[model samples]
Every structure is written in C-alpha cells, then in structure tokens.
Target: MAKKQKEKNNEVILALKAIVEEKGISEELLFDTLEDALVAAYRKNYASSGTENVRVDMNKETGEIKVFSLRQVVSEVNDKDQEISLEEAKAIDEKYELLDMVQKEVTPENFARVAAQSAKQIVTQRIREAERNIVYDEFHEKEFDIVIGHMQRKDKGNLYIDLGKTETILPPSEQIMGEEYEFNEKIVLYVVEVKQNPKGPMILVSRTHPGLVKRLFEKEVPEIYDGIVEINAISREAGSRTKIAVSSNDPEVEPMGACVGPRGIRVQNIVNELGNEKIDIIKWSEDPAELIENALSPAKVINVIIDEDTKSSKVIVDDNQLSLAIGKEGQNVRLAAKLTGWKIDIKNEEQYEKELQDALEKEAKEDPNVEKAIDSDLENLEKLEDEADIEGVIEDVDALKDAKLEEETLKEEEVLESQNIERDIELVPKDDDEYKFKETDETETEIVADEDYEYKVPEEEKED
Candidate 1:
C-alpha cells in the first residue's frame, strides 16, 4: 500500500508535465495560477469552520501540491464581506483596520473536498484562456502584411477564414466585388487592420484596396518582390479597371514588358485571377504632361497644358479625337484625372483655336498702341513750336538737320575764301533766277529729336 501511494503520486507529476508540454505552458506559470486560484476560492467560502485562508504551492521536482485556507478573526456575525472588526484586524497585522479584510492561513486539510475541486476548475479555466491569448498574439504579429488562408465557412454573411488553427473574419464589406469564394477556397488577402474587441481579436482582410492590387502584382511578378522592379502608383476601380505604373532598375528589361510577359501571358494570368478586370499598365514619368497623356490611353493627345499650383491640366485633342479622348461622359479623362490627381479639361483643336483667337482680340482691344499713335501726331504740333523758337524756315527736325549740313559746308567754303583773296568769295545776288539764302537755324536744337527715316517726303502721303 505504501508503494502504491508513491506510484499514484508519480502519476500526478507526470500528468502535470504532459499538460505543460502539450499546451506549451510552463510549469512555473501553472504553479502561479494554482496559488492565485486557491487564494480566490478560500476568500469565497472554501475553508473549514467558515475560514477560507489558504497557502498553495507546487514542488518544482515532484509537482507536489498543497493548499491553505485563510481568514481573519471577526467580532461581528453580519455579512461576510467585512472580514473582521478593528480589534481582530490588528491581531493579524498591526496596520489592519476595522472592517478590513485580513489573512490567516489554514491548510487544505483544513478545507472541504468540494472547495478544493472548485479552485482547481477555476485555475484550469484561467490557464486555457492564457493559452488562447498567446495564440492570438502570435497571429496578430502577422497582420497588415500579405497572408494566405482557407475559407472555412460563412457566418452571418461573413467569411470565417482559417489561418491554420485560428479563425479570422472577413467582413462582407471587405470582400472583393463579384469575386466568388467556394468552400475551403485558397486565397490571398492583404491585412487592412487589426482590432480587439470583447469577442476576440478581429483581423481585417481586404481584396478591393489598391494595395491589394499592388500586392497581387508583387506576388505574380517575382521581380517586384525581390526589389528588381517596383510599382510606382496604382489607381483602381475594382472589378472594372486598374492602372498600375511600374519602373525598373535594370535598363535592358522593359518594366512594362516584364509585367505583361511574352505574348501578354503574365498580365493575362493576373487578369484571370481578378475575374477579368481590365488593367492598364503604364510607365511612370516625372513630367506631368507625359503622365497625363499615358493615363488617358487609346486616345491621341494634341497638347497638355498644366497649372501646377492647383494640380490641374487642360488637354487639347483634335476635333475628331475629342470623343475618343474623353470617353463616354468624360470617363476617360475622369479616370486620368484621378490617376494623376489633376483636374483635366478636354477640348478639341478647333475649340482651343477659337478660344486662343478670342483672347488675342480682347488683348488688342485694350492695348495702348492706337491711343499712343494718335497722341504722337498731335504732339508733333508742339514739336513745331519748339523748332519755330529758332529764326529759321525749317520747323521739322529732319528738314532742319539737312539745312545744318548745308550751312556747315558753306561756312567751310567761306573760311577757305577768307584765307585767300576776298574776291574769291562771291555774294551772288538774286536775278529772279538766282537763289537767295533762306537757311534754317534749327541745327543744334534738333539734336534732342529722334531721327526721321522716310523714303520720299510727300508730306500728305507719308507715314511717320
């Protein structure tokens, strides 16, 4: 009988060890849990003689268990919520107060069997809950990154996704539009966010986000994942059209062709996975004009004018190309505008030309050229006054300048004649046919005026 009891004790130790191993919970943690449970149960009426003070401990090597119940000396027989009177509280610990809960240890041999079982159950529940949280925390670490899961079942119109042992919920709103999920369907999802609630940890998955598209591209295009190429931007209206801009580090490999594959096999596979949603693969450019042109594809663009401050642009197309450039109800340009974050206005070449001509006419109407020309003609009258100040027949600047030249020549001739005999200087008198000198004295005063340049001076017909 002595050996049999020892064998039974060995069995208990082995059992505890197996639980810790299988559950991945440590033996030390199990002891702490047992101690806490015993304390709680003893306080809630688990001890003999109505005193439930307990001390619980586990042997590290043998896994031996012991329990103690605790209570405080009380003077009153009222509600159990009050542990003791002020006098009794002082006996256990001097700092104890009246109506204060105090502790006095009583071994489990001092408690009933039913009370011990209740404490054991409580401890077991707590251990299981801790294990569950450990699992939740492990999976939460993988959130917001790409993940693959099997479709378990739909609950309340939401997908119960199974990531191995744990189940994640894919809410109805997050499911891809028009994409069907069969039972146990293998699928990929991008984790949008993780939220904790009273029920459990909620892993939010997405299939419609632009990030989803980018991630899908990365998965199918191995070059993207390995960092040889990168996706620059994505603009998508899921289940309809998606535009992705891709660039590459390698100069020889065309990023677009690599994505599209030979004979369009690569992109075709991606499109098939997405339920045939059309994709427009475009090369990204730093120039806004080039990007905008690429965004509105399948349509020839005449010109693109941008207002960078507001991030807006005006696209001009040929008259026959307008409808094609804008699509139905401006859908083409609208998609382009969203893709580029620019407001786009599409106009035909004729419309643009008309607008340009109208602007030019309006500018000419307000110009000061015509008014200045009229003022210049009237101002010539005052110029004649300034010229008439000199005692001369020449009132016009050009004519006065010519007269000055002639006078200078004659002065030179008279000086030369004076150096010689005065008889060489002839003062020719007018014989009706002989000319009299009527030289203009507007010589130096005309210096301030702009020189007049005209072919033949027929005053009435000349334009100055």
Candidate 2:
C-alpha cells in the first residue's frame, strides 16, 4: 500500500508537468487553481458538519496534498471542530494561549474522484483564461497596422478572417465597396482596433481604410519602404478613387515616378490589391499653389489662387478640362481637397473671369472711392484686353500705315502726271511752225518734231 501511494504521487507530478508543457500555463498558477477547487470539493462533500475552518495545502515540488482544520483556543470549547480548550492547545504547543488559532491535520481517507474532477475543471478554466490573455496581448500591439489573414467564414455581412492564432472581424462598414470576399482567400487588412471580450479578443479590421492603401504602397514600392520616398498624404474614396501625395528626400529621386514604377507596375499592383481602385500618385510641394495643382491631377490647371488666412484656394482650369478636374459628381476635387487640407473651389477659366469681374464690380460699389475703384478696374480690364490683343493691334497698325503711304504715293504720282501733261502742252510749240509733217502711202503722219515723238494720222484724215 505504501509503494502504491508513492506511485500515485509520482503520477500526479507527471500529469502536472504534462499540463504545463502542453497548455503553456505556469505550474504555480495551475497549483493554486487546483488547490482552490480541491478545497471547495472537500467542503461540499465532507465539511457539511459545520467545520468551517478547513484549508488545503499542496506541495509544488513533491505533489503532496494535506488538509488542515483551524480551531481557536478558548477557555471553554463549545464546538469541537471550531474551538479547542487551552489545555488541549497547550499540549500540542507550549506557547499556546487562549484565543490563539491552531491548525490540526485532517487528511481525508483518499483524494476523492469528485475532488480531482473539480480540479480538472479549474485547470481547464485557467488555461482558457490564460489563452485569452495571450491572444489579447498579441493583437493589442498590432492595432492600427496591416495584417495578412485568410477568410475563415462569413455571417450576414460580416466576415471572419483567420489571423493565425486568432480570428478578426471585417464588418460590412469596413469592407471595400463592390469587393467580393471568397472563402480561404488570402487578403490583407488594416487592424482598426483590438478589444477584449468574454468570447475572445475582438479584432476589427478593414479593407477600405486609407492606411490600407498607405501600407500597400509601403510594401510594394521599394522607395517608400526604404524611406527614400515618403507618403505625405492620402485620401481615399474606397472603390472609386484615391489620391496620395509623396515626396522624396533625395532630390535626384522623383517621388511620383518612383511610386509609379516602370510602366506603372508599382502603383498598379496596389490598385489591383485594392479591387481596381484608381490611384493618383502626386508629387508633393511645399507651395500651396503647386500642391493644389498636383492634388487636382489628370486635369490641366491654369492657375491656383490661395487665401493664406482662410486656408482655401481657387483653382482655374480650361473650360474643356472642368469636367475632368471636378470628376464624376465632384469626387476628384473632393479628394484633392481632403489630401491638401485646403478648401478648394474649382472653376473653369470663363467662370473664374466672370466671378473676378463680379467681385471687382461689387467692391467698386461698396467703396467710398467708387469712381476711382471703377476707373482702376476699367484700367485693369483694358490692360488685360490690350495685352490679349497686342499682336493683332500691332499688325493692324502696320497694315494701316502701309495703306496710307500707298494712297499718298498714288496721289503724288497723279499730280506729277497732270503737271507733265501741262508742260508738254506748253512746250508743244505755240506755233505750228515748230511741228513737222510727213505723208506715206494713203496715211499722213505729224510729228512734234522731237526725236522722242512719232505721230500717225487716221485714214479719214489722210483722205482730206
């Protein structure tokens, strides 16, 4: 019987070691849980006789179990289990005095099966609690970061993704619009939050988070990963479009080009990962005007007028480029506004001019120097008009000067011709004697008698 009892103690020690190794639970904690459970079981089965001072102690190294009953030393003992006479207590300890509590060993006949089962339940409960704490600590550090997981299941509109040791929730609100999630499909998600609950760690992840796009770029673009290119800002409309601003520390590196990669493979990969979401990689600039220009991309911008105090900007584009700048239902400009943190008012060149004209007129009306303001505005408008038509005006002036010179030259030539005719008449001999006449065949010729002159007469005249 002694040998059999020794073997049983060894088995208990081996079982504890196995539990510690298997569950990753500390032996000390297991022992404490087991002790508490054994005490409860002992009281339930044997302490029904009002023995309320029972305690159980276990030796961690040797796996020894002992039960003790504590009794207070009293002048007179009323309940034998709860109190002892001073004489009886002193017999056990010479220093015993009245009102002193003393312990007496009360080992049961055997460690009952019911008590062992209760201890098992306690150890199991403790293991589960320990596992929960471990999972919570593990995921708590991962909050606000990207994680890779496989789709585990879906209920209603919520998805459960298996993230190795635990599962996370991707609710409908956090899912990418128009994106389909398939079973066992590997996907990347941004860990939005981590919470502890009665069931386990509740990890909330998202596919539509702007950080998701940021992290995806960081992963795909080597420049971003190596810190050569920094992502300055990101604004995403989920499945529709996203705009990101990036800058490079190295002047030689082009931020937008680097993110775009060769033939746009780098950003294209990210776009594919995000369910074909359109991405615009813009070069960041410190100048608000330049930055706003970059933020509203794929559409040519004519100018950006900024109000530093209001942190707002007016963007001007060509009339034909208006629809592109504003995007479908104003999504482009909206995202650009978000990316730059500036209230943007986008207008075509025509609209801007009209607004500017109206504003100037309104200002002119409000000012005390209304005439002066209106005059200044008119001067500005004229200057602008002149500047626009300078080439045409210069050409017209040159053409008019040429025409006037030609008209004067024609008039002078006519005057000279008339004077020469008068001079010829005057020189044409006041006397006919200065003339010479000749006849040939049936025609008569008269000459002015000058070497430069040849004259012929008509047939009718020749008859005469």
Number of the top candidate by lDDT? 2
Local accuracy of candidate 2 as per-residue lDDT tens digits, 1-464: 75676667678888888987876777888777778777777776778574668888987776678888899999988998789999999999989998999998877877644577757776678778877888888889988889999998889988888998787788999998787878999989998888899988888898989999998888888999999999999999999899999999999999989999999999889989988999998989999999999999999887677889999988877678899999999999999999999999988756756787897778877886777656744654464444343444678876776666466556645764788622121122233222333444444222233333333444564576
Weakest 10 consecutive residues of candidate 1 by summed lDDT: 443-452
Residues 101-161 of candidate 1 have per-residue lDDT tens digits of: 5655454443434445767788778777767766667667866567889998887878888
RMSD per model, one decimal: 17.9, 14.7
Identify the leading candidate in terms of TM-score: 2
Give all TM-scores, in the order shown.
0.60, 0.69
Model 1 stretches astray by more than 4 angstroms:
1-34, 42-56, 66-107, 110-116, 124-132, 154-157, 319-324, 327-331, 355-464
Whole-structure CA lDDT of model 2: 0.80
